[model samples]
Target: MPNSDMPQTRQHCYAYPHPAVTTDVVLFTIRQRTLSVLLIQRGTPPCQGMWALPGGFLEIDEDLETCAKRELYEETGIEGVYLEQLYTFGDPQRDPRERVISVTYFALSQSDNLSPKAASDAALADWFSMNELPQLAFDHAKIIQLARTRLLSKLGYSTIAFQMLPEYFTLSQLQSVYEILLDENLDKRNFRKGILARNIIKETGEYSRLGNHRPAKTYQVVNPSQVEIIK
Candidate 1:
């Protein structure tokens, strides 16, 4: 039975999902003792002329880390490095269109082998000194600050620093990396004592040649699974 007041059939509520879920990779590298972060110039609107971290929408059946690595490769032509999940960004107003939640990842790579080749969609991709980053799109500034802080704090008692360094490095080079990240000069004697006390570095019985100085011995980060530095 149709009633005069009921002029139409029942209407159902349809849900439109958010734009997409994505993962952004914040690749950090230490070159000549200064920390650097990777960024790319956007090729589209909403921040078309701005610099941004490497990222993109996740595939339908991809894992977060996989998506992060893929985006890194796509935007910067880099691959295969130690990457760790940093944090997630989901401020309602972060994206202009629909909601977007980006899972951020941090990675360490060798500055020598990395070559910045912008993807087809990116105007440019390059590494900038961490101290002199330009205005970034989205909440990238906040993400970079957080990553820098975490890297410094963790360096105090963790083996995470090895990720940013080559497999074999000199004590001076290692200390330099610490100084750049911590933003504080460390006494040579004290720094050596702290590192040696950890029993986490093994002398490789090899030496490295430098300009206008005596060759320095090389050392490697002892496997954490095999050595216990801090109790």
Candidate 2:
């Protein structure tokens, strides 16, 4: 047997096997308790012209979160917000063209008065309610489900719901968002007590003057930096 110190005649270079790692962002916003996800129309083959989440290949030096935010802004003109890592998808055949792996991030944003501008390779970008989604390309549908589950779990104890609301809103409006996301009715008094008890919200001294009944007082999530869990 050759001495262990002897070098082998064969040469081997490190190669990145299969498809490269990529990143996908599931940007969600809530309007009237209806959850909406941002999607872009693809401009190339493999899923050309189909709707998909805003995402792209990661740069060699880019971190996962950095890639996600860059992709979000490049594809949908969205920026500067709370983004949480959700999951990674690495099915060998997930991408027809290559064995691409994707790290998915879920981003929350205020649903009111924010419109997306299509950029990058996206010909069009728009927010679609989870219920009314068109056929999504790739494993994006699955990614959305994963994000939804994480969001719901977080809502039980975290003030994550406010990420989808405006700076000032009525209690009913906030409650509606909770009901929609949780898919259940929350007792008004109980909800109020829980919310007030948390001390994470502040009265805005504003009211919704256009409602059928007397205008409800408006409030906003206080301590924007607080990440209180409801549970």
Q: Which one wins on lDDT?
A: 2
In candidate 1, position 108 carries an lDDT of 79
Separately for all candidates shown, the number of backbone clashes (residues 3 or more apart, or on different chains) is 0, 4
- Tens digit of per-residue lDDT, candidate 2, span 8-63: 79876877565688899988887555788999999887899999999999998989
Candidate 1's C-alpha runs over 4 A off are 1-19, 224-231
RMSD for each of the candidates: 7.3, 5.8
Regions of model 2 farther than 4 Å from truth: 1-12, 15-19, 205-208
Candidate 1 accuracy as TM-score: 0.87
CA displacement after TM-score superposition, residue 157 of candidate 2 (Å) = 1.4
